[model samples]
Target: MAHVKDLWWKTVKGPDGEPTQVKTARFGKGKRWLAVWHDQYGSEKSKAFKTKDPASKHANAMETDVARGEYIDPKAGDKLFGDFAKSWFNTVTVDPASEIRYESVYRLHVGPRFDKRKVKAIRPSEIQACLKELEEAFSASLAATALLVIRGVLELAEADEAIKKNPVKSKIVRQPKWQGRDVKVWSDAQISDIIGAHPAPLLPLPVIAAGCGMRQAEIFGLALEDLDFRESVIRVNRQIKKLGENYVFALPKNDKTRTVPMPANVAIVLRQHIEESPPRDYTLPWEKTDGESHTVRLLFRWPTDDQHVRARNYSETVWKPAITAAGIIPPPAADSRGRKRYETTRREGMHQLRHWYASVQLDAMVSVVALASYLGHDPKVTLSIYGHMLPSADERSRSAIDNRFEGSGLVPDGT
Candidate 1:
């Protein structure tokens, strides 16, 4: 229950023999009303008000909220966002790769901005301003990632009832669209030139990439047993990712295992490469922090050393040089200020092959669901990325309508 009382200017003795009315400015203005109540824990709490009506209203609401178990302490939200984020991070369970990404975003982008601010004190405008700053300072994709981390932290705070609402949600703070560089595909001649320039052991890499649409990590993690020749499918189950000096085997992105149909040329190239060079055992940790190990007979290995090829080392020594030799990238330019010279390359990554594979499937009019399954992505995601590659619906519609009148004798001769 809550009650209200007035403080008069004249001193009055209480049961404890102390002055009940203390001299204050409120006494001079005749506005010394106080709402009195006990919290859920039976702790006495009071808020001074200027008049009887507002104080009584506030006291009643607080009492009702406390009784109904919906009361949130005003001081609970005073905790610093940086401290709360550390707690939230521990509560989330994620893979090693994702954990690394989260920590990096927090350290580089999120923590420094809101470390000193209380969680509840963060307003919607502040969040929007931070997002705008991030967009200006970094790529849109990176800005989106940083905002995602901040939103996650605020969501946890909201769930804990530390704040009445999360400012990072919905229209309050929107993540900028990732306006990345345009997608580039290689021509048949360009593909041939690149493959010819690469070494013999790595000859099948380009074929598998363009043919099966395997990501670089998945390509490096491919094993001989994962290929089913009879079914003509490549079973993509796992990928190798680098964490510091250790290589760990983890499930593919989204933890999805899929089988992609193998083209005839791709299968033929894989068979020839396997016959010429046998697979060797590549051992790695099953988990980054654990000592447990797993070994697989990797399809591709480094030429000089019998080990699974690392993506970075392979890209620099094999793929980059191949791009240069194939005339895809120009030779390194000489530096004028006595600095080391560097090469200028096209904006083509190994992912371009994946894009080419998507193009091939879409041009053939494959079902969106089937294509997404083949690429180990959601149907909506596949459409967002490759929907433009689908054949024009207007042309098909016109052809369908035109064919209806053909051979029906309803078509007139040229007038």
Candidate 2:
């Protein structure tokens, strides 16, 4: 049939107008079928079917589809990129923030700039130039995010026959890597000096935060019962995070509960402190009953939960003074020179204590897996980031160990 092709119904003028011609041939799977002349202009194509009934049906529809010029070519369906992306966004459901970012990129960055353009119209040089503009006009992270979204949308457009190829895939956009920070790890001397400077309200907190590496909220949320003196473990089951105005103790982040081994000194200090000032179920110092506040009630008295509205609030009021007394650094030189002196304080935030814990664990040569379980971190993350911090003698063997054999004229590889 392919060799004997171009056979169609020819319309000759006058008489009965035209004669309907049909051809027979074996198609795929070796089945014989009748072919009809569908397109006489424009596409000038034809179709085939196993029966005359379906062939006739297709002839009528093809005539209509051709008349309206709606018969799109499957091969060329993916000719445009941006126009296809909008449809892709509507069809896809993703994480709320990611979805918002994808839509924003399409509307504000990609669609308006390239919607009218074809798939092949987006050039590599042009994409790089656009990316550079994005970095300058916004932030590197935002630019990278926009680039990734554009690449995904374009690929989908190609799949949906909206574009011929994914142009944005080849575009260059560097991702930001986590750089090591020059964070102030609590040294032995600094820890000693800081611990000595504060004696009362702020005194016990440093021991919990710096010594055991408890977060300020975790330290503040400690109830007399949460401490296990016999086991020498502090149960960090609850955390005080500000959901809005007032800080409330919530189930720990990632729904985790971890017990931190405590030193005998820390335990003694806590026991003495608890005996002196007891809290109810380790509740905050700001617990309220019918709008009434009490002391010796919450270890850390914060504003009533109903009074505040913010997420992740720390006990800074008590922390600042403790930090000043500890001499880690003074609370930003109190601004007294009007608007010019209103500089923000450089006090280390809450996570410093967490970082301090990880540093100590690494310095002690604790296994990464152990630290991961202890800190409630994903094992893979702990291994990749902290595994190298304090390398064990036998846990990991570097090339330097084999260098001794090499220097002594040994070649395991038979060199």
Candidate 3:
């Protein structure tokens, strides 16, 4: 049950023994009307209003909401968004790398805007405005990640009954849209030049990337035992990834361990590489930097250090130099301090090898499902990315008709 009380006046027995209303001692001090109700938990809750009608309506609405099992404590969302978001983030379980990335995005992008605000005070328009600002200030991918973090926080708030609704999910808020560019695959000549330009000891790095479609990290973590020459399949079991400042051996991206077919040429190159350079044993923490220790006979290592390859160091010192020597990119220019600085984009990275492999597979008429399995991608995702590289429907139809008509005396006749 809910009721409204007049805080400015009270009813009492008069001198005539009849009930009469009179101003209370606290009259003219604070709101005149109070809406008081018991919540679903049977706990008293109240709101003050300057008018009697609004207070009565609020009390009635509270009673109706409680009866309908849709009640939310108005004060519950008074918790700061930063506090609730941090607590919610701690409860989230993801891969160590992803967890670190989420934390960074929260701290850098999400926290600055909403940390000090109360959860209930955030509105859909405010979220939309924030997203627009993020879109302007960061890359589309980062903006999307920021939106994801915000949504996760608010969704948990809603689930915990701390907020009446998740503003991030409101119809007024729109997620950042990312229009992915078509993958531009490198030509066979370019691949050959790049591979040929690599120093003899690192020749197999680009070969494996172009042939097996292994990611750079996966290549860094390649182990001798994971290669099966007899079966001609590379077991992609683990990858070396950075957890903060320390490197750790972790499962491949998406926690999926898959087997990719090894091309004959790739296997031959690998054998030659092993004969010349030989695999080196290295130990690293498993999953987390401080987790259990694990060792593997890695195929690639920094030449001087004879240790696991650091991605940044390898990229700057090895991969970029090879590409530059191959004429894929211009030579490094000297900065004001006479330090060599190369103008390189992600387009010139080893990931281009993956695009080249996917293009080769698609051009060879491999099925999308099979290519997806070989590349450790979802079938739909593979199709979305490499579908443009596949033979067009019109070309396929023409080929089917031409093959059916061949040797059947169905040549085109001049009209």
Candidate 4:
């Protein structure tokens, strides 16, 4: 292909104190070059060279980029990922706690890699590499989360005509070895250890989580308004996460807002917790002090929209330590940040409660569709992940050995 030299002429004053003659190219496809600059005084400017050598360098670079078929300006993408993310957050900012989790994924994983890359040029290989890199740098769970943001961004890109197709296809989306982590769940017997034990305040949530199969945030996000003592069912509709010094409430994950059957175990404690627990504006029992506490009767995401926060602070400040104190998990100080260590405890995150609840429900052989409804899971998701978690999986698998003749018993006995 033919090429032209670049002739970049920066404006300058002549020795005679007049604006110097405009520099012209001696040997190139053209003898003229143009200056592009901001007109505002002392604003900003840049020059494009129009000479054979320097200009050829530009052409050569651009040519090489075209040959590789993978070059986009660092600043001229559909939008810088970070900038787009912030705007998106503003438009859809959940509660403070949810913001923290999203920000964590943005800062720690997604933002740095794709921030400046144009959305259109984002390749499947690049996303795969990103998922792989996160897996290497962090945990499988963290890798899954990073991909979550990437997937959302690509979907936005497709919507905006930045790309023809979303790069994050189902098969290309990576799935790390999760759903089988060796987490220690509190068994039915172990549940007794923590009831009104030392620290005293930790008892109620664990009971609720393990017994009713509610998630950690659900346990904390429960407000007085959602509880129905007469119905023996606690409505779990919203939750929260902690961000720096404040709370941000948001909707439940998996779009899950459910009503769990309250057994006498969880119900009795909840009743006692309600009376002694002060009327909180949001539900979770956030620490009022190291010793005393207050109950949040309601939680607000933006005080207007619908969303919930992480329920993380309550987990750290209340749930985990309490579980440890109950002797269900190891004592605090398990995971630390170097010499400046935070307290260690077992059952570190609220997911533990979720796991225990799943295990309990599985042990009880709760029909998966019903389980999905209770846990607010999409139809197939609960069966896919926890179907194996059921102790009856072996029995089900055994039944599968020769059940091609499966028939409806409700049909005539002759049939």
Top candidate by lDDT:
3
- Model 3 Cα lDDT, one tens digit per residue, 1-415: 7999999999999999999999998899999999999999899999999999999999999899999989988888898899889888889888788888888989998899899999999999998888888887876667888888888888888998988889887888886754325478778988998898787877888999999988989998999999999999999999999987889999998889999999999999999989988887789999987899999998987889787878888889888988887788999999999999999875789999998999998888889999998888888778777777887989899999989987777876444
How does model 1 fare in lDDT? 0.81
Q: Backbone clash tally for model 3?
A: 0
Tens-digit lDDT track for model 1 on 1-415? 7988776454778789987866654555746788888888998788778888999998888799899988766667898899889987998787787788878978988898998899989988888888788887866666777787888888888888888778886586776763313455667677778778778899888889888988888988899989999999999988888876678887788888899998899999999989998887777887574747878888998887777888877877788777777777776566887653337433556777788788888888889899999888898878777777788999989999789977777887456
What's the lDDT for all of these models?
0.81, 0.58, 0.88, 0.60
Clashes of each: 0, 18, 0, 43
Question: What C-alpha RMSD separates each model from the true structure?
Answer: 3.8, 12.0, 2.5, 10.2
Which stretches in model 4 have alpha-carbon errors above 4 Å? 1-100, 118-121, 155-163, 175-177, 181-184, 196-202, 248-250, 254-256, 273-321, 325-347, 392-415
Write candidate 2's Cα lDDT for 1-415 as tens digits.
Answer: 1111332333345556666544423223332333343443545455555555665666566566556755433335436665567667777765333566677766788677777776655776666777777777765556776677667766776675444456665635344222234345656676666667654544787778766777665666666657788999878876655433344555555668888888899888887776765554333323222223322234543344522212233234444444555566555554456422212233355456666777788888676777777676777756544554565666446666675676575655575
Higher-TM-score candidate among 3 and 4?
3
Determine which window of 10 residues in candidate 3 has minimal summed lDDT. 174-183
- The residue-by-residue lDDT of candidate 4 on 1-415, one tens digit each, is 3255235344568888888646555434444442333212323233355444665555455445445654333223457556656656556545444456767887877988988877766788888888888777776677877776777766665565445577788476666544544555665555555444424344566677667777766665767777787888888876654547645444577555788888887777767765654444533323211222334554222212333333544455555555566665565453355432245443355566667777777777777788887788865767666666767656788787537435645434563
- Greater lDDT among 1 and 2 belongs to 1
Q: What lDDT score is found at residue 4 in candidate 1? A: 82
Candidate that beats the other on TM-score, 1 or 2, i.e. the better one: 1
Clash-forming residue pairs, model 3: none
Q: Which residue runs does candidate 3 get wrong by more than 4 Å?
A: 132-136, 171-178, 405-415
